[model samples]
Target: MADYLPRAPWTQRDDLHRMVDALGNAPDGTSLARWVGGAVRDGLLGEDAADVDCATPLKPQDVMARLKRAGIRTVPTGIDHGTVTALLPGGKVEITTLRRDVSTDGRRATVEYASEWRDDAARRDFTINALYADPRTLEIYDYFGGLADLAVRRVRFIGDARQRIREDHLRILRYYRFQARFGSALDSEAEEACAELAAMLKGLSRERVAMELLNLLGLPDPSDTLLRMEQRGVLGVVLPEVQRPAIEALPTLIGAERQAGLAPQAIRRMAALLPLSPQVAEGVAARLRLSRAQRDRLACVAGRQADDAANPLALAYRCGTECAQDRLLLCGGDPAPLSDWEIPQLPLKGGEIVQRGIKAGPEVARILRAVEARWISEGFPDRERVLRLLEAELPA
Candidate 1:
């Protein structure tokens, strides 16, 4: 396992080495730090682990002071929760002191720092996430059978599933997200607990829920997990007002998206999970805090009609190649038009209509639009040819 550490991206850099070395030594000159969580899990799986988080025995202030003394930049990103971020040349490394839950209310937790590594491991939600590795010696630490669970492709909670969900309701979505990534069979206990607590997801902020849902949608093949979520009634809890037809279309849409070489997008997938309507897209965007661009794209994608976007010239001219390709993919039609469609600029302008002796009013606008339409129908004629066609419509 130690040999695997150096091969991971986090441990191969010198600056990270120096930062880890500095955080390892406490004020008393005793070494008490180890890399924990995803970095360790991904390293053992032979995946690229870039983000590094470490567990230390030092308290938040002590960790900050030690890094400050070493001339390293530090930020108290989650100081009350016993975590600080050190800015290194390679990237930011989050260092968290060992902690046990003092109290939890399903939405948040009050944490008390702990000195024991086992206690720290126990508080984490999942077994695979609690595994730790010593940075210097490269020793794997598994206090909760995480290595075994990882080997079998199981995603089980560290302790009782219900208790973990009670600590943070977001774990409900996380269960599915992790299942989409690393799970082969559902842990019956975890699945039951999630089904029971699916309603508690309402207490979580929409932004947080949106983030998790987006992440789950990003997986290479989330069709199985989504199908399970639908069957389990968990998908309805998050999107109560969604259209059933859209949900029914997901499996086919996902297959088409993959075949069309399109990367999974949350809004695009979410749009598929609702009735194809601009009104519904706007409502979902408002609820999820999606940015303006995301909201606009969702509206456009949902409003698209397959037959209308089938023509390469019209589709590319109006919606661009990307939108046209996405629409074709959603409608389960040929997407070849997007590869060859080239939009032509309109040859006539309002000023040019005014130059043609048309009055500077709504009539000038109308004339220009008429000429432009004719030009489009004529396969986009040149400026001179368009002006010649406009002669009849000019002032007469």
Candidate 2:
């Protein structure tokens, strides 16, 4: 029900008040600081905003000096970029000076501070993100039609869509991400602009692209937005390795994940969007510059084919609990056995087998492996039963 004003509880916290109070001694607290960007946008939606950022007309150094004079602790997090972080008792607030982009190269932008609030808002990517709130006035400021856009769940570019994208190609990915999280549907103009300039995405770093795509995949159900991206050729521009068949298989995995009471993971969903081939998964993972652990996990689930009736606990012991769940859900296998089962290490050892009168050589190792295999096949029996099984492996 918040409109034209933000009623976020974090704004009323005493720590935040202390931080803002340090910014200025104005009677109404104007001309000092106002909450900006995601905090304001999410707050107005009746959601608890985790990150509370602010904008001030004062330069970063001056703001730091003021905070220090008021006994406030400040970190020069991005001082060169006109951003300073004020540590409050409740949380840290990122205080950035109002700035306008001086130039952009479709990757990074050079910015210069400006006194006018609108100048700062103009440089933002989307209208809904341009919302701002004055701490003292208790009034929300909409330089663009952000409030109206929020009302209709529409995400529109601040100015020309193509120009906004040209300024930074990352906006194309951001548009889809925002649409998946906030907007009820895709904006045709924004979608078309992204398609027209989709090639510019090649200019971005692989890390950034992977981050956005993984974030999108992490959503509960991004099937519609993903399908739109595929239709628009936007997804293909970044990840051509994902063929249509694999992408189509995502919904089934999503449903299986839901039925099995498991949360959707970004990497798991990404693994679902590829053929069941470890080689293919490894190749795509390397291209995206994924971390070693992530690359290995993708490989683990990619080549695996889980039977619906297979022992999920055994699979968990083999690859990992997470990988087992992923393979089962992706392959239409049941993972209920892992719900309460605790994976146990083999109780019998090679030394125990050697003491059973077997030669202390290759045959002992072979017997130990055979006994371990039998133990696993029997669903991991007690230590006594394992010893008996090892006795059976020894030469008579």
Candidate 3:
């Protein structure tokens, strides 16, 4: 029992109090209290808290009713699991009733509500995430030695690692992400468990696996973890096309420091390593439920190789400004140097070519391409030079 006052800002403290007050007035004796997750870990690490999740003894319906009484919008985010999302001005808070897993098929779990906080913490994936904090007092309640594991920077599963993985195969990838993000060392039991259950990852849906892999790549040193997963045959089973060549080339493709930024460009750089066909990539993206923009950007990056930078202006023009910038950054190129060259704007249009008696066919496109190439070669001269080139190419 570590007594730490709630160090969250006044606004957050007020919000928590608001929720707790609402929970207190609910029909059931259940009251809202802070539960384990990023809030507790980030509070201890002095990192900015992104989301606050609370646990209440009240059932989902009761929680919703209380929120309605408080004039807060409540969404049934996971009604089956007794989770409701409360929308707030700055951010949203997810409040879930304490639950215990009754049955699980390593994909989804069937849960039953519990009145005790210890039951909820015990059911979580890792110990570091099992520590709960009091919303009003900000006191931490550790049912397991999560605080000890956090202080020692060790990632230990709550119960048996193998059993936990069988409960949810996605935890394997989550374990890697946690290790990479928190800079924690994995215990032998956990490591062995990961290796043993690596093959079970195939049972997970591609979308789920993809989401977890993306999160893993967001870590500081995802490469090492990815390599370990690959060595243990987990990567191949889940993603068969990601071979050693591409994995080895990832470090060179995107430096570790930049990849740690967790930008879309970093994701693209890493995705390029997979030897997936265009159709396969599209399928994978669809299965993973990736946004259209993400799929397109990743496809664009994968289509181009490092040695394809012979025509810098053409590359910039084809890839657009942002993608070009990302590509340069991924390749460790100085973006400042290339920032000055403006994309060559054509002076003449297809209509102008037709007006000049040139056919509106392949030749029109060829003429424009030639003029644009000449403009680029001449270091993108003034509009006057562009006009002159267009005039020369399509003389009236």
Cα lDDT of model 2 by residue, 41-122, tens digit: 8887888897989999899999999999988899999999999999988889999999999999999999999988999999
Candidate lDDT values, in order: 0.81, 0.86, 0.74
Candidate number with the higher TM-score (1 or 2): 2
lDDT of 1 at 58: 88
Tell me the deviation in Å of residue 315 in model 3.
Answer: 1.7
Top candidate, metric lDDT: 2
TM-score of each: 0.90, 0.95, 0.87
Name the better of 1 and 2 by lDDT.
Answer: 2
Order the candidate numbers by TM-score, best to worst: 2, 1, 3
Model 3 per-residue lDDT tens digits across residues 218-287: 5545667777778877777776767877777666655633543434354564565565455666665676
Worst 10 residues of 2 by lDDT: 1-10
- Per-residue lDDT tens digits for candidate 1, residues 182-270, read 99867999999998888899899999998998899878777778767877878888877665566667778778877877777777787
Total clashing pairs in model 1:
0
